[model samples]
Target: MDLPRTFTIRESEHRIHNPFDERKLADLGAALHLKPGMRMLDLASGSGEMLCSWARDHRLTGTGVDVSTAFTAKARARAAELDVAEQVSFVHGDASGYVSSEPVDVAACIGATWIGGGVAGTIELLRRSLRPGGLMLIGEPFWRKTPPDRETVTACHMGSRDDLFALPGLVAHFGRIGYDQVEMVLADQDSWDRYAAAQWLNTRRWLDQNPEDELAAQMRAELTAAPLQHILYQREYLGWGVFVLMAR
Candidate 1:
């Protein structure tokens, strides 16, 4: 019914729930060439930025679902802010087993493939709700190069090197999952900096307010140490991109 307490806290603060800034998300959505009537189902749609913006810009209709109540509220508020509340809905629930009541033109699981255990399983889950020829939008991270050491990978919160694939390998992974490469929008180091660095300030602010909270204390320590770690490891050696795939 909810994500971890730490994430809920972060979402409530409007600090780190959205990974992409508005412009990057707009670019990604534009690449999909949405039409007025197209339907979308965005799993793990944090803050519903993608859905709300697309609905406003392209006149698309959709439902966005996430486990975070804080994000769901933000998403709904965003829809209203954008004057697109009639075109989209936000549901606070687990996205892993969610299926659209009607077939959709696109189905997406962005930055949360773990919902279905991994890329392959998540693709299968999304496909069930997609109409024939519907696009699948998968937001994923790929290594810019193979991690030189376990310590480097660990800093990115990865358990092991095998948990990630290099950029080319990730594309091939889609092929292995029976999807064809269509289009992609990659995130550069600057974008990653924006995403990762912003969290530091958010966590710092939270720590200022709730110094005694255990989760905040751990996150504070982690956030404090993350920038140097990212600059040294992830920023120097890894990359991330959101890929669009079609069933082959």
Candidate 2:
């Protein structure tokens, strides 16, 4: 029903939750040329930033679903803060197997494709809620450079080399699944730094405030090791992007 406390603690400060920064997010919204009154369904919608922001900027209405109760509350607050509470709603529940009651103009599963087991299954899940001719958005990671060995792949947090494809290969993947890649916005190293490095600070600050907490030791260890791990492994080998697709 909810995410692990450790995971929520590590990402408590994140608005978008993935590697994307505010500017990249806004740019993606703009690139879509979103029209007012369009409807969107966002699955695994961490903190609901995409839905809330687009509701404000594009005057769209949307629903976001995530399993993290803390993040779901934060998302509602953000909707209110942006004065778009009426345009967007968030549900605290599992996004897996979630299908919209009505078809939407956009169906998205950003950065949490595991909800549907993998890329192909995730696309099938999203398509269930998408109107014919509607767009689908998927945020995923691709290999920036082929890892030299198993150790490097593990360091990048991937179980095996097959877990992700290279950028060009990823585009080809969408095609194989019967969708055309229409647009994409990628994350630079700086964006990766913003997402990964920022967690270190949050963990450190929390550890400082609650040294006696049971999770403090774990947080301390993560804070000590995360930055180097990210800089040396993930930032170099991994690239992330939000891709827009249309049914072919």
Candidate 3:
């Protein structure tokens, strides 16, 4: 009913919990031309930022489900903070195989497709709750370029080069799967910096406060190495984007 403590600790203060900045997120919502009262179902909806923000900005109604109890609570607090609590709800549970009780105008699983094993399986899970002609959103990583070696691939936190497609291949993948890629918003290097670099600071601050905690040693080791690893590998080799899809 919750994420691993280490995962929560690493992203303790992240609101969006992905590479997307607030502006990019807002732009995505606007690009969808979401209407008032549209219903959205968000699976693996970390911190519920997408649902809560869209509910406030677009006047949409949504439900978000996540396995992280801490993140789920943060999401509910975020909804209330945005004064959109009445428009959105968050559930703390597994997102895999989750289908909205009512068909929804949009179904999404952002940055957590592993919940359903991968992009294709996650899309199938999301489609179960989507109304015909409705949209689906998937946020995922791609290879910016083919890594030169297995070491580079491992440094980028992927098991193999096959773990992610290049940008063009990713688009082609959607087409092959009987979905049209209607819209996409990509994260620039700056967005990646914001998402990754912020964790160092969060980890450092936590370490300073919880020096005696059992996880402190691991956090310290990560803080010592993550920035260099990210700058050298992830920033150069990985690209991330949120794509909007429609069933063909």
Q: Among all windows of ten consecutive residues in candidate 3, which has the lowest summed lDDT? A: 1-10
TM-score of each: 0.95, 0.98, 0.98
Q: What is the lDDT of residue 83 in candidate 1?
A: 98
RMSD of each: 1.6, 0.8, 0.7
The TM-score of predicted model 3 comes to 0.98
Displacement of residue 162 (Cα, Å) in model 1 is 0.8
Q: What order do candidates take by lDDT, descending? A: 3, 2, 1
Q: What is the lDDT of residue 235 in candidate 1?
A: 83
Error of 3 at 107 (Å): 0.3
Q: Please report, as a residue range, the 10-residue window in candidate 1 with the lowest summed lDDT.
A: 10-19
Across residues 138-200, which tens digit of lDDT does each residue of candidate 2 receive? 999999999999988998989999999999999999999899999999999999999998788
lDDT of 1 by residue, 1-248 (tens): 88887765544545224446667888988888888999999999888888888899999999999998778888898899999999999998989989998999989988899999998999999999999999999988877888888888888779988898998889998998789989998888787888777767777778888888878667876776878998898787777778999999
TM-score leaderboard ranking = 3, 2, 1
Residue 1 CA displacement from its true place in model 1, Å = 2.3
